[model samples]
Target: MERPVAVKTVAADLLALPDWRRTALARFEREAKAAARLDHANITAVYDAAITEDVCCLVMQLVDGTTLDNVIDCADDGRLSVLAAVSVAAQLSSGLSAAHAAGLVHRDLKPQNIMVDTSGLVKILDFCLVKVLSDTDPQLTITGETLGNVAYASPALLGGEKSLDGRSDLYAVGCLLHHMLTGRPPFHGEGPAELVTQHLTAPPPRLTDCGVDVPAGVQDLAHALLAKRPEDRPGSAADVYEALAPYLPAPAPAFATRRMPPEDPQRPFLVPHGPVMPR
Candidate 1:
């Protein structure tokens, strides 16, 4: 039997609350517009959307999967295997690259907003906080008004910067990667405000610091993505994808299972050992 298609509609309770109606409606509209703009394999597909005086509706692909938050919680070690983590990161980077190319900045990126299916495919979720990178759409966030999950927010967002770009998403990618491998985010605080301050002023954390034995290159990539200065992170999501390709689970089997042939003294080893990340 075919399952019924899921339709996202404004909650009856929300509609009944006069104080929350306007803001909730605006958020619903923004989410619809943002998801509708992108056509990417790793992004959720929006089929349709509409708004009436009191009701908001969005029809989208029924993603039959759990959020990354649940995946993390279900893991016994509180983290994914290295291959699984890399695969998730690569797919996420591809999706973000496509969105950035289309001038969209996913302001709210976190485990709760990323879905992973049974096939191991990733589908980014929720654009209620998405920002359109354009001159006309000035930053809606004012100074001291932060938006996004504190743990995954970029320094710019935490600092309440008036502008954001693809790098902002890249920062959240770094946080996600760190969490996937280390079983926790790179930084944490006792409260939300302190968490934002940590994002703004804390030094990038290393995967090694958490005892995760991933390749040094992966560790460096995480640090680069989490750089306090946006200019220091990978220039774009495309760059991130390139760096993560070798570790992703595809074309090649498990990176840990591949055995390098022993070196012969007579002939020089043509290929270097592993990916050499830039400092």
Candidate 2:
């Protein structure tokens, strides 16, 4: 057992509510199990979880790291440098690829759920909203409401669709990538209801619109990921990694991070930088 694990404690008030506690703890335990079954360096490891009396505790690997949100905030400006943003997204794609393959869909991915360790290793956290695709149980995601953060929720999810797949998670990765490079999420509104409307109706914006001088290819990738329809996005997380490989700030040492098997050597290489544009 790892010492100094990150332990999540449910608030006493929430624990005292029988209905809320039962539903919340059940989802927490199931998602924790799903995350534990995955073996990806970039995905946070779940060590243990238990509900004692009315309290729920989830113990996870203690990462000596900065939250991705903190990293973004610490940037001299409000956003990450282009290469850094792409590199983070690439690593995240690898982690999500493993989870998707394991039949897990991370429904609530956001910058707050990401961490970059002291060694510059990226790990994704919080699987409390995960859905197990292999189960095909309608009850898994049928709460009559959207389940993820409104700002990052996909159009289908905001529409209260009964089923969501890996593509929905990919949409969030797109939003996360855009946020990393722009210091803001792709969509914004005064409230959750307005945000949902924007996601369902607004056109995907370009990096240039946010006044970031990243490569055109970078913006293009974001657009693909943020496509209003799930089918319009990249086929898989591996495909996303391939699209992002050219912009990775640097190579991983000793292949420490996972990579998809060799693909056609003819993959297109996008230019890494472009002329600086005025904000």
Candidate 3:
């Protein structure tokens, strides 16, 4: 019997460019291996993967919901309510924590790559496709490889740093959080180069400046995550989760929510899924 699964195939165009083809193929293989090793509720599970010169495809768990891109687009003014936004960020942080625990980093994190299941659980997609292509022409390959995701790229990553860690991913989470609450990314640019310059030199935009009414602590947390140096950012994804936990809506009696349905992101936290299990 055939089962439902989400299949991700390497873009043929990527393989057509000699600068991207060779390194792209190898990165696909590494991503496959890394993804297969991770198992977490907030992360899309990888069941199988195959890589070759001509083909590279990954089969993943098929989630029953929409991408965060849709979630953002469908929200008021393209932004979630403060409570709902926190819930989504919390889940994303949880997924990041899991990947960090497994010694993996989700280098590319953006709304297009986040999923919100029907039950309101947020799942991080492509947790292991963190590898950016490196070819003979490094700058060209880097820019091409991270096209859509450069908005969330960390300062260190954009600065040509060879080493990356969980902190880098946290920077993207900051961008995510900012985007979710403000209807826009923390930094806006005319092109990739301008965005890179902002991420590298400009201080991250403050939530207060955006006219969004969020808690002071939450705003501070977002700014700290966008810190330039790795050590300056939150120590780990776990730290981020804890910081946002206070903002999660408290679970109400099941009866209370029957008449008034909970929001998309609150569904997973406000309602019980099953008998509680040991953590």
Candidate 4:
């Protein structure tokens, strides 16, 4: 096909390291398989993947805007408005619900893997660390290495549970939401080791401590997601979406505001049966 597309190549730094090359290659392939299993509005579409002794790359739909991390970076007070944050959560959970139903776990769901297009539609990116729940293949991860971004990983992930499922991703959603509203992660440490230790032992901080004026229920939802135990978190992404659903913009064209962020996540949910945002 002759068209514009985004190409993901194995990181040059990893490629330069003989010790990391094998694992990086395996992860690149795993990402392709995991992403190919789902077709969702919020998940980035992977068109193709290929690897050999000499090359590795994935062709994906080219995202038109910025990473969620950048969005937070540029926002006032380094945080999104409550409505914008909730909107992002709703779309993200909707995508997660589909991935979970397909028996895949996005082991890495940090904000850096999320894209916010010009219309405010959210697109999940970088499935390099994805886990297929039903697959018996050995996970490409190296033991003793921090899994995913320690900042948003679940206790199960940071502490090395035998198995991880959708709840793990929900934990990341909690972290993302908290970051969106507070401009920082639920926990912090001097390094990966300390961060992992804190994830295993320390409780996630209350959203109120950040002085965010969200509703009581929203605060409770964030806490539920950050619960140290996956079982204590919301049952599934679908459930989380329901909790956040009420905050989505009404799907009425009449509700359009005079001014809104170009990357507003509310745009997708507000249109009257509009086409899905470009993958």
Candidate 5:
């Protein structure tokens, strides 16, 4: 048998706790397996998963490339190349299209969750935090707390509401695109609570303010994705892709370029650059 890729797995013991905790893990495994069953260029491939007495280890395909978050940090002037940003957006939308078709909502879609391999092949990762709509379990609720990474969460999600679907992920993708173009998320504040409030009430900072020449279509798409009401956003990931299709470069074969040089396996390629926004 082929040896597994050398990637660290989240230990089950570390995640050990009440049944509520395991519920999310179990959902992750189920959705990941479903995602793996689909053949797509933009979705991360799951190799194997084992639940031991103390931990669960999911062996996923090792993607060798920097994340969009890292790319944003190294951008020449706090802005990504328009072409590069569009390409990444296209790939992200494509991945979301597949996931939505399979009834999966990537509750967390952000720069950190997007991995761009050396050849510019973009794959969406970290489905451990995904929300599968068709599952029988009740939506995992944390009383007096919110779920998901605050920076990229949709306004509805940040508002402590439930019943979000693919449109929520679309909002996050819009936020990611905005960040790629401007090197920052749409809303920023002293802390998570403030940011969530901004998501719910504040108008997004204009992309033009970032000193980037973004096209009107791209701007409109961003606005639509970041719309406060989930119903106001694009209907689906495919719809988001369609809106941006005129701007996307031709689709090249997956891994079109030579493999990018590997980073130190011991270190995470993208480190959180700033303090976690307050809550």
Candidate 6:
């Protein structure tokens, strides 16, 4: 059989695994196809899926740009500029909306999962961890077990919940947004176990505490997205977009200024008498 075209994008190369793992890949391919039916900018494009002698490869679009995680690293003081963060949130919400509409849950959302192309197009990647609502694959629930990225996993997943839906993805988006603006995940500790505990019990440090000027609307959206209980979050991804829309860059043809908002109300109210809020 002919080798697949080489692409520099992550997940471009198929990894060799056991037969059971190959089955998992096949399931992921089917889920990706189901997800592609909902056309959106943030989700990765699935082109083809094939099985080689040793591995199963799912060919996807090669997005050229940096992952959100890397992009945040390049920002001033580690956090993204407010304008840029909002822009990213808007794109992410749109993508999640499409997936939810298609009855799919990303199950894994983090800065590393979001890819921003050189052209400034934001694409959400790695649907290999996606979950389809109606067609619950037996492989997905290995004797009532949940499998997902640990750092971004929802509280319910951590509690050994068997069924996770769109809200789980929203929780992850919240964490991603928090990381984008604060240069750190909302819940972090010495190790993964502590991080999981933080996700379940600890209130995330305020975005402003990170020394960045995030708008109240943006911060509220992040908090809402990061709500501990899935029901406490916005009803859908569209709600998240609506909450974040005001902070996004103004709609211009091109080459428009992307300046930070003057002041973020969600940030602690600056008392003219007290020490000035950190810049």
lDDT values of the candidates? Answer: 0.78, 0.78, 0.81, 0.85, 0.72, 0.69
Report residue 23 deviation for candidate 5 (angstroms).
3.1
**Distance from true position, residue 75, model 1, in Å?**
2.2
Each candidate's number of clashing pairs is 0, 0, 0, 2, 5, 2
lDDT accuracy of residue 45 in candidate 5: 83
Using TM-score as the measure, name the better of candidate 2 and candidate 4.
4
Candidate 3: 10-residue stretch with minimal lDDT: 132-141
Candidate 2 yields a Cα-based lDDT of: 0.78
TM-score for all models, in order of appearance: 0.82, 0.85, 0.87, 0.90, 0.83, 0.80
Worst 10 residues of 6 by lDDT: 264-273
Best by lDDT: 4
lDDT of 5 by residue, 1-279 (tens): 576463445655546656556655665567557656656778888777766555556777888788878877877776676666777787788888898888888888877888876545788887876666776565454466556789999887777656768988888888888888888888899998798789889977767777778899988888788888888888988888788878765433332232333321111112111122222
Indicate the TM-score of model 4.
Answer: 0.90
Ranking by TM-score: 4, 3, 2, 5, 1, 6
Better of 1 and 6 by TM-score: 1
- Assess the local accuracy of residue 269 in candidate 3 as a C-alpha lDDT between 0 and 100: 69
Candidate 2 all-Cα RMSD? 8.0
- lDDT string, candidate 2, 112-224, tens digits: 88888655668889887888876665544546656888888889878887667889988998999899888899999899888888899999898898888988788899999
lDDT of 1 by residue, 3-83 (tens): 454478888797778766766677678778877989997888888898998558888777766798888777768888777
Give the per-residue lDDT of model 3 (tens digit) for 1-279. Answer: 398998999889879999777767776777888778778899999998878656689999998889998989999889998888889989989888878877777878999899887667888887545643222334324543443377888988777675678898999999999999999999989998999999999998899999998998899999999899889888989899899988888876563335333227777767646232222
lDDT of residue 49 for candidate 5? 76
Clashing pairs in 2: none
Writing each residue's lDDT as its tens digit, candidate 4 over 59-92 gives 8999888999999999998988888899899989
The C-alpha stretches of model 1 lying farther than 4 A from their native spots are 1-3, 10-27, 135-145, 250-279
What is candidate 6's lDDT per residue for 1-279, written digit by digit as tens? 364432222242433445356556666566657755867766777766665454455667777667877777777788777777777777788888998888888777777778776556678887766777887556655554456777778897777775777888888888878777777778878987888888888886678777767767777777877788889988988888888777765544222223222222111111211222222
Clashes of 6: 2
lDDT of candidate 5 at residue 11, scale 0 to 100: 53
Judged by whole-model lDDT over C-alpha atoms, candidate 3 comes out at 0.81
